[model samples]
Target: MSDAARRTVLGAIRHHLREARSAGDELPAVREAGRGPPPRIGEREDLVREFATRLGAVGGVAWRVAGIDGAADCVASIAAELGATRIALSDAPLVRALRGRLPASATLVEVADRDAIASCELGITSAQAAIAETGTLVLDAGMERHRLASLLPRVHVALVPVELLVADLDAAFAAYATREVPAAITLVTGPSRTADIELTLVVGVHGPQALHVVLIDGA
Candidate 1:
C-alpha cells in the first residue's frame, strides 16, 4: 500500500475512535456488576510444561533445556534428525553458539539474503517472548529483517528464554505498555500451514513447515 493510502486508513480509524468516545456508545464491563474478573493463569503454574503441551496441541514442538548450552545441543540433534545440511540462524547471542556445533557436513548460516536463506533447510531465530497459554512466539518485526530465514525454510528453530514466557496475550501486552511502541509484533503460533486448496491440508505454504522451540530457563 502507498503511504497516502496508509495515512488515509489511519485517519479514518482515528475519526471513528473520536466519534465513538463522543457518543459514549460502548459500555464498559465492570466486575462489580456480577461479571467475573479477567482470567489469569495460576501464579504457580508450570509454564514450561504448559507451553510445551500447548505448542504440541497446535503442531509445534518445544523442548525445555537447562540453559543456552543445552539448547544448542538440542538444536544440533534436531537438525541432524531431519538430515539438514544447512541451517540458517539469526544473529542472536544464544543461537550463534551453535555455529561450530553442527555435524562437519552441515553448515550453520547467519545472513540476510533470500538466496542464502533458501539454501538452508532449517532456520533458527529467537523470540522476544513466548505465550504459555496459546503457545506463541512473539518477535519484534522489522522490514524483512530475519523474515526470510524464518519464513523460507522447511524447519524453523526458535530460541526463547523461559523467563520471557507470559500466561496470555493480556500479560504479554501489559509488559510492553511502558515501553515505546514497536514497529510491529509478530506472533507465531505454529508451523506455517493452510488448507485453502480443494480441502487438502498443506504445510509450509507461506512459511516453515515444522516449528521447533527451545526454551532455556537458565538463560
Candidate 2:
C-alpha cells in the first residue's frame, strides 16, 4: 500500500488507543498483584489426568492416551462400547488416524455434513484448547470447520492435546487472542444442561447428551 494509506491506518489506531486510555481507567502499579487461587501446574501426565477428571465431573467421559495410535484405539473402543453404528469423525489428524482401523461393525464417516452426523450416534473432533476451571473445551472453527460438528451429534468425542490445556479462563483468552480469525469459537462445558424449571437440573435438553474427552499426551 501507499505511504499515505499506511499513515491513515496508523493514525486511526492511535486515535482509538488515545480514546481508550483517556477514559480515566485505574492505572496499575508497577508491581500490582493480588492473592488468588494458585495456578495448577503439572507434568504432561498429571495435567492430562486432571483434564480427564474435570471432563468426567461435568457429566462427560474422558480417556487418556500416550500418542496417536493410542488415541485411535481409544476412539474405536468408545464407538464400540457405545454401540454406535454410524459415527462422524472430524478432519483432525487424530481423528483421521482412526479412519480405516475402527471396527467394521460400525460405519465411520469422515468429513460428513454436520446434519448428517447429527443423525449418527457419535461425532469426534479435536479441540483448540480446554479451560480447566470451567471444564470447557475450546473448539476453534478453523480446526473443526464448524462448532456444530461437536455439538449437534448424540455423542461427541473431543481430542484435546495435553500441551493446549490451560489452567483457567484468563489463560484460555490469551491463547485465543493469538490465533487467526475462525468461522466460530465454541466453549463447551459438559453436556447441554439447564436448570430452567424451578431450579431442577436437566441434561441433554439443548445439545449432545454425552461428551467424551480424549486427552492426548506427547503427540
Candidate 3:
C-alpha cells in the first residue's frame, strides 16, 4: 500500500458516503439494509444448557448449581483441584458473600492489592450478564476490581446468577441500554488463546489458563 493508493481509497469512500447522504440515505439506513435476519433461538431451549455447551466448545467449563452454597462448594472444589494457595476476589456483593464459604486452605486476597494479585493463583468475581448464544460473560467496570481479579490469575472463576442470563447479544445489549453505561465492559467467552502463523493453537498465553463459570439458582 502506497500513500497515494490509501488516499485514493479514502477519497472514494468519502465520495460514496456523500452521494448516499445526498440521495436521502443515512448511515443507519445503510447499516439496517446490510444487516441480516437475527438467529432463531427456540423458546423452549434451556439457556443454561446452551451456555454450557457453547462454553465447553470454546475450552471453558460451566456448572449450574442450586444456590449460593452449591456455588461455594463448586468453587472450593476447583480451588482444591488446582491447589491454589491465594485467591483474588473482586468487590462485588455476590463475590463477597462467598468469602465465608471458601476453603480454609486458600487465603483470600483483595483484587486491589497489586502485590497480592501477582501471587494469586485463582480469581473469583461476578458477571453482570451472560449471553447463552455465545457463552460469553459480561463484566462491567462499575464493579470494583473485577478486571484485575478476572485477568491476572492462572485460573478464573465467575459466579453468575440465573436471572442475568440472556438468549443472545441483542438481548444483552438491550439490557445494558436500560442502565447507565460503565467505563468499560468486557465480554469473555473462554480462556485466553493465541495461535502462531503455522495455525498451531495455544491457550492461556495472554490471560487465565482456565475459566470456570458457575451459574447459581435462586439468587
In order, candidate lDDTs are: 0.81, 0.78, 0.87
Q: Once model 1 is optimally superposed onto the true structure by TM-score, how far is the C-alpha of residue 106 displaced, in angstroms? A: 1.8
lDDT of 1: 0.81
List where candidate 3 sits over 4 angstroms from the true fold: 1-45
In the range 1-219, model 2's lDDT, one tens digit per residue, is 699999999999978877877996655656556535555555665655666677778898877788988888898888889898988877887677777877788877675576677777888889888877667898888766546568777888888777888877777766655778777778888898889999988888768889888888777
Per-prediction TM-score to the true structure, in the order listed = 0.79, 0.75, 0.82
Q: How close is candidate 1 to the true structure, as a TM-score?
A: 0.79
Ranking by lDDT: 3, 1, 2
Worst 10 residues of 2 by lDDT: 29-38
lDDT tens per residue, model 3, 1-219: 699999999999999999999999857544554534554454424888898999999999998888888998999899988998999999988888888788798899974977788689999999998899999999989755698889989899999998888888877776665788889999999999988758788888869999999999886
| Candidate with better lDDT, 1 vs 2 | 1
The all-Cα superposition gives candidate 2 an RMSD in Å to the true structure of: 6.4
Worst 10 residues of 1 by lDDT: 35-44
C-alpha RMSD of each candidate structure in angstroms: 5.2, 6.4, 5.0
Candidate 2 global lDDT: 0.78
Candidate 1 lDDT, tens digit per residue, 1-219? 699999999999989988988998774656564633444665534877788889998799998888877987898899889999888888767777777877678877777778988999999888888888899988876422556677888999998878878888777776665876578778899998888989787867778899999988788
